[model samples]
Target: GALVYQYPRRTICKSGTSMRMECQAVGFQATSVAWYRQSPQKTFELIALSTVNSAIKYEQNFTQEKFPISHPNLSFSSMTVLNAYLEDRGLYLCGAREAGDAEQFFGPGTRLTVL
Candidate 1:
């Protein structure tokens, strides 16, 4: 079975700092995994590929550096966010899927709170 698991489930960091979040794709090959941020009382905003935005502008960490999607033959992926701010606080979801597959498996996600 294909599954994506994100650790920490939740995290709290000081404003103007960095935090590292990780995701593990298991049981099957993943061609891509998307990281998203769910805003408070708002829909998820695009953080990056296979991932995030409705009226959302992604930060560099998500758009430029692109937390590399795990190869279809691999099962792991990671991303780190630097300089977390109040606007950056939200639920981070990881969505995974394989090539030619329509179903996307989602991880429980890591919620971030910037102090």
Candidate 2:
């Protein structure tokens, strides 16, 4: 079994600033971490997937330059939102999975608010 914990649960930042969020996996090895953003319209968008010892794969509209991720080991991961803006305000989630596992354990998500 696996469990993920993300923090800070909610955050507020001024426009044009940046914020970093972290995700941790417990009870199992997290071979991969998938970052996602849930939009205001309640749509989940895949941001990127980071696998241990492999390159991070970014989705179509996502770039590593904007959302740099760090997955240095099996149980920890973090990502930074560069230059926060209104459009970037959303709930950021990290789903971690073990190797060869189809089920992902999701964190409680980091809610971003830009003003």
State which candidate has the highest TM-score: 2
The number of clashing residue pairs in model 2 is 0
TM-score computed on alpha carbons, candidate 2: 0.97
Across 1-115, the per-residue lDDT of candidate 2 in tens digits comes to 6789999999999999999999999998899999999989888899999999999999999999999999999999999999998999999999999974669889999999999
Q: Which ranges of candidate 1 are over 4 A from the true structure? A: 50-62, 65-73
What would you estimate as the lDDT of candidate 2? Answer: 0.95
Report the Cα lDDT for residue 101, model 1: 57
- 107, model 2: CA deviation in Å? 0.1
Candidate 2 RMSD to the real structure: 0.9
Model 1, 56-98: lDDT tens digits are 2345646534333332334666667777789878888877776
Choose the strongest candidate by lDDT. Answer: 2
What lDDT does candidate 2 reach at residue 30? 91
lDDT for each candidate structure: 0.70, 0.95
